[model samples]
Target: MTSLLRILRFAPQLNPLYLGIAVSSVLAALLSLATPFLIGAATDRIVDAVAGRTGVAEAVTAVTWLAVAFLAVEVAATAVVSVGGYWGDVMAARMRTVLSTRYFEHLLHLPQRYFDTALTGRITNRLNRSITELTQFLQFFANNAFTMLITTAAVLVITGFYWWPLAVLLAVVFPVYMWLTAKTSTKWQVWEGEKNTEVDVASGRFAEVVSQMAVVRAYNRQEHELAGFRERFTKTVGLTRTQSRFWHGMDAWRRLAMNVVFGLMYLIVFVRTAQGLFSVGDMVILLQLMNMARQPIFSMSYLVDSAQRAVAGSKDYFAVLEEERERAGGRALEAGEVRAVPNGPAEARADVVEGETVPLPADVPAVRFTDVTFAYDDDAARPVLDRVTFEAGVGEKIAFVGESGGGKSTITNLLMGLYPVGDGRIEVFGNDVAGLDLAAVRGSIATVFQEPFLFSGTVRENIAYADPDATDERVRAAAKAAYADSFVEGFDHGYEQIIGERGLRLSGGQKQRIAVARAVLKDAPILVLDEATSALDTRSERLVQAALEELMVGRTSLIVAHRLSTIASVDRIVTLRAGRVEEIGTPAELSRSGGIYAQLLQLQQAGTKEAKRMLKEYGIHG
Candidate 1:
């Protein structure tokens, strides 16, 4: 109940309407009490007429007007309830929209480390479940709570008129009812929270397996994957069943107790009527009022369950809401004229700026990592980037060559401001990357990841994502530069061809080229090409590499390549070992020096026999 109050604080706009609903529901319950009294009065008047009492005609007239007024009040109460229902629906819709929108915005600003620890499907599930429960809470819980309160008050007040003892007895039981409700609801709340977590885990596992079905098939590990999924599913089912059973047991107990209490009330009412304490009409009114009180108790029990579910769902929702956003530091970058430095590397110069060594702007480095360190968990002793430092300057391409889990992509993420720096600072344009506007930083760079993502739109739209306002001429030129226009033109719809979700309709190379075209259109000063040509065939690779070279001419470029030959043309080669920079120098310099980069180059030049021997020694294979 306290949780419900706290959650309502997020949506204060609905408070007035909620108050109105409560007031109307109370009025309706009060009016409903009159029906019983009117019937009792009419019954007594008829009894007087039958007993030869004086002024029977006036009594009959008064009874008729009382009955008419009772009917009118009942009709008005029904109208108010109907209007309250409509308002409840409207409030639910508005809350769903506002909370869902805020949730999305929060997701957009959260640090990349959050995603590193969280699963995409799980985050999505939490968002969906939270909004759904929140809507239900607003629509049903608020109105029902008000109805329960009014019903309880009406029952007590009406009972006081005929017999104060019955009213006092009900008042005594109210606290017991509330306590039991709170205890059972607390247990259910904990169970519900666990159930929600299990559901998210199951969803995450299922989505991961489905998305990587190709890898499973290639390895012929279908049975193994199925076994793992089944295990996870079984655990989730067990948790769900446990949660359901507990709630069912609690509900059964509540119903049995309620029945016993109502039976006692009925017995007391009957005894009072038999003693001539009240007329038959008075007995009917007492029974009706008791029944009304029972309705709220039953409803309250049901509401406890609903409230538990909402609490569980809200925990997940607020987790997202409470996530830390990208630190803006209330600082905006100076919108000065950006100039291209001629006869220079187009990267920031490695010189002291305010007592800190900043990268060269003329070099226009694809990226610069300056003693950067990061960890998803604050308690983690080993950082993902352990004082890692390097620079890939303009017209100077660099490749990150290392074993998997060597923090290659972590460096890329830091450069992109997807994650915040924990130890040392990073700079891009003679400005602290931390202080730079994230949009402005990303706007100056383009990336083509290993797995290219495409929206559900036409090919033209996908390529033009880098620059939504790009002209047709610019789009066509970019496509040509990426060597994608020829193949696109060959297609039936050409630029208008629709690509399915994530470009699943297109082949790997086709998607890669389209991604390249999108990046080319942006024409950013820096480019990060992560396995851009790794998915291409030999012929496609040759053409794509040519296009990439053209795009890399004036901009700083960072390329992560799997094939050794693909990186031979890069100006510098940086070898990473366990999250730390092991070697950094030009390809020619490193190859002649016989370091980690040289050994890799030598292994690449060797035949299959030596290559296999090298892989056996280094524990790496093609």
Candidate 2:
């Protein structure tokens, strides 16, 4: 119930629509109350005519008027119900929109680590399940809740007027049935939660298998994956069977209780009519009201069913929404407040405006990592980077060469603020990264990763991702610089060519070049190439390396490379071993220093089997 209330709070603008539905529902229900009375009056008129107690013409006239009034009331009620239904449908749609939008926005603000540890499909599955149940319940309640209450109230009042005992019998059934249903609430919800877990895991795995179908086929594990998927859903089926039996078992008892009370009411009404204590018309009206009361009474079970599912679904939804959002950039200060820039002159105090770019001081290095340390979120895991320190001067190109898991990529990830450093500081252009606006810090850098991820969109769309508003000419120029323009022009649609998911339709080189083109289009002051060309063939490597060289000029470039040839032209090389910096020097100086870098360089130059063994021993890739 609390979760349902929280869901409603997500869309306050729908309040007026909800109120309108309630109003229409009440009007419809009140007008419907005239139905039984009109029918009873007509029945009494016929009885009088047949018994010769009233003149035929007068009896016919009364019956005719009663029919007309009943028709008018039914028409009005229908119109009111139609309006309420329309408003309910509209509100439900808008509720879904608001919920989905807010959930997606929340995800965008979550920390990167959240994505690392969570499955893509599981996250989306929660959103779909939660919003679907909430929207449905909201729509159902809007259309039926007020009408049910009003009808039930009218039944109580009318029954009391005819005979107070009949009202007592009808009212007693409601609480008794409700109490019986409440007994199963805890157990029902427990089963629902357990079923949801199996469903979510299956959904997550389903998405993962689909996305990696190529790998599955390559390894001939299609049967294995299918078995796993089936096993998960099979468990859900077993749970549903047990859950259904319990719910319906309780519902059977509730229905039996209601039927027994209704039978007693009927006997009392019949006995009174025969005893001359009430007219046949009075008996008719009482029975008709009882039937009306039954509708809402039966509907109680359905509403409870929906409410339980809604509560359970919303529990998961609210849990995600309640998580602490990733920290954002600092707000702009007042005019008199001082904004300190670390490593800046102590005498200098400045006012910082929100969302405005402030240039770095000229003398500050483009990038700096001072005694930085980090580890993944595992108790047994060692630090990936331990007190690693390095700096890149403005417009200088530095390369990091190391064995696998030697912290080469970790350095760039820290500089980009993807993960928090455990100790020490990372400064981007002389500002402590911890306090600087993350958007501003990341805006000045562009990265080309080893695995280029492209959406299923047009080439133009992917390239313009860096700057959505960039003109066609700028996009083409960037593509040309990355040597992708020629191949793009060869396509049937030129720049408008549709690139399949992750550019699956294109070759590896083509995909890498497209990624390079995106980075070129960004044109940030700092560039990061994390094994960007390592996966390409010889010819593709040359082409991409050339494009990278063109992109690196006049910018501060951070290069993590396995092939020594790629770093031969870098201004300096930083060699790492076992999460620590082993050596840092110019390419020529490191080549002769007999350090890790020199040994790897010497081994790479030799193509013999012994050289390969030595390289493998160091876990270095040639």
Candidate 3:
């Protein structure tokens, strides 16, 4: 109930339309009350002529006037209801838009850790189910809530004027039926929640399997996945059956109670009229009013059902909204400044006027990491990074080389502020990362990941992702710089060719080159390449590596590589093992030092003669 009330808190902005619907519904209900009175008058007049108490001519004239009034009232009620219904439909659509946009905006602000734990499909399912149910209930309530209230009240008053006992009988049904329904509410909601869980999990798996259909077929796991999906839905069906049985069983009891009460009221009305205590006209009106009361009593049950579902839906929707949003500030960066971070004390440098270039000071780096430690799981005993300290000077091409899961990628992630730091400091462009604006930091840095993630759009769009407003000429130049222009030009539509989801339509090297071109267009002062060419074949790797070389020039680049030979030309190599830094030196120095770098080099040279020759050519003598 509280959750449903919280949903109403967002309705104030649409209060005028809400008020309009209420007023119209009330007016229609009032007009509709006139029908029974008009019919009752016509009936009495006809009875008088039949009993020879009045002339047929006078009776027919009275009945004709009443029939005309009844027609007018019915027409007016219909028109009022139509107008209210129109307002309700419009309000419901706008509410859907408001709720969906609010949910999406909050989703974008939630920290990365939220996405890491929640399934994408399940998150999407919650939004769809919750918003759909809520808006439906809201629209129904707006159209019928006031009408039901006014209609039931008028029936009670009109019936009581004729017979108080009938009013008492009608009133008793409400509390008894409500109590019966209330007794099952807690259990009903519990079942609803369980069914929702089953549905969400099954839907999540459905989406996952669809996206990875190639892998499922490759491994011949289609039957296995289908069996899992069916098992979940089977559980959902069983739960739904049980729930329906309970609800309908209670409904049967409620209807029986209503029927018995109405029968007594009807018997009383007939007996009292025969004893001359009530006239035929009075009896007719009383019975019709009682029938009207029956409608609202039945409608109450439906309203309760809708309210219950709405409460459940609002609970799920607001739960996500209550989550902590990311507090990272939005700050833009200045262009053409060589900010420095000193290893020891601060060094004095000349300050220049606005937009003037400053020379980078000696022994000062563009980026610095000091004793940084982090772990994905807070309860885990071993952290992913342990007191890792490193530096990348301005315009220096530094590479990190290590085996799998050696925290090489973790360093890059930390530098990008993708995860919160556990201990120690990280500085980008002489500013501590924790205190600096995240947007400004990210603005100066560009990253190319191992597997390029591109949206399903044109090749030109993918290249311009780094700068959405970039001109066609600028896009072409960046593509040319990355050596992707040749292949792109060969496509049927050239730059306008549609790349499928995650660049599925493009070859592996083609995807990587487009990613490289995006970074090239960004032209940031700092570049981070995380195994960019590791997933390609020899020819593709050569092409991608050549493009990467062109993109990395004159920038502070950090390369995370598994292939030893690929990073041989870097200014320096930082070797890591088991979350700890093992060695830091130039490729030539580390090759002769017999550290992790030398061991990996030896392993590479132990392969084919061509591999050995490649290692030797990269200045590795093992």
Among these predicted structures, which one has the highest TM-score? 2
Query: CA lDDT of 473 in candidate 1?
Result: 96
Regarding lDDT, does 2 or 3 come out ahead? 2
lDDT over C-alpha atoms for residue 233 of model 1: 70
Estimated TM-score for each candidate: 0.84, 0.94, 0.89
For candidate 2, write residues 308-393 as lDDT tens digits: 99999999888887766654444432222345443336576344333233366779999988898888765737788889898999
Ranking by TM-score: 2, 3, 1
The runs of at least 3 residues in candidate 2 whose Cα sits more than 4 Å from the true structure, single-residue gaps closed, are 330-358, 613-621
Candidate 1 — number of clashing residue pairs? 16
Q: Ten-residue segment with the worst summed lDDT in candidate 2?
A: 328-337
Local distance difference test values of all predictions, in order: 0.76, 0.86, 0.83
Q: Which candidate, 1 or 2, has the higher TM-score?
A: 2
Please give the distance, in angstroms, between residue 436's alpha carbon in candidate 1 and its true position after superposition.
2.5
lDDT tens digits, residues 1-622, model 3?
A: 7776677776578888889999999998899788789988988999999999999999999999998899999899989999999999999998898888888978875767888988888899999999999999999999998988899888888887877877777777778878888887888888888888998899889888988999999999999999999999999899989988998788888888888998889899999999999889888888888888888888877888887788788888988888876543322222222333223235653332222221334567888999998999999889988999989999999998765677888898888777778898998767777765454566678899999988899999999987888899999999999999999999999999999988999999999999999999888888999989878888988888998888888999999864666678899999887788889999999999998778667768578777666544333322
RMSD (CA, Å), each prediction: 6.4, 4.0, 6.2
What is the Cα-based TM-score of model 3? 0.89
**lDDT-based ranking, best first?**
2, 3, 1
Worst 10 residues of 3 by lDDT: 349-358
Write the residue-wise lDDT of candidate 1 on 141-258 in tens digits.
6566777787798789779877898898788667777677787777677767777777787778777877777888999988986787677677767876887787678777877877
User: What is residue 511's positional error in candidate 2, in angstroms?
Assistant: 0.9
Model 3: colliding residue pairs: none
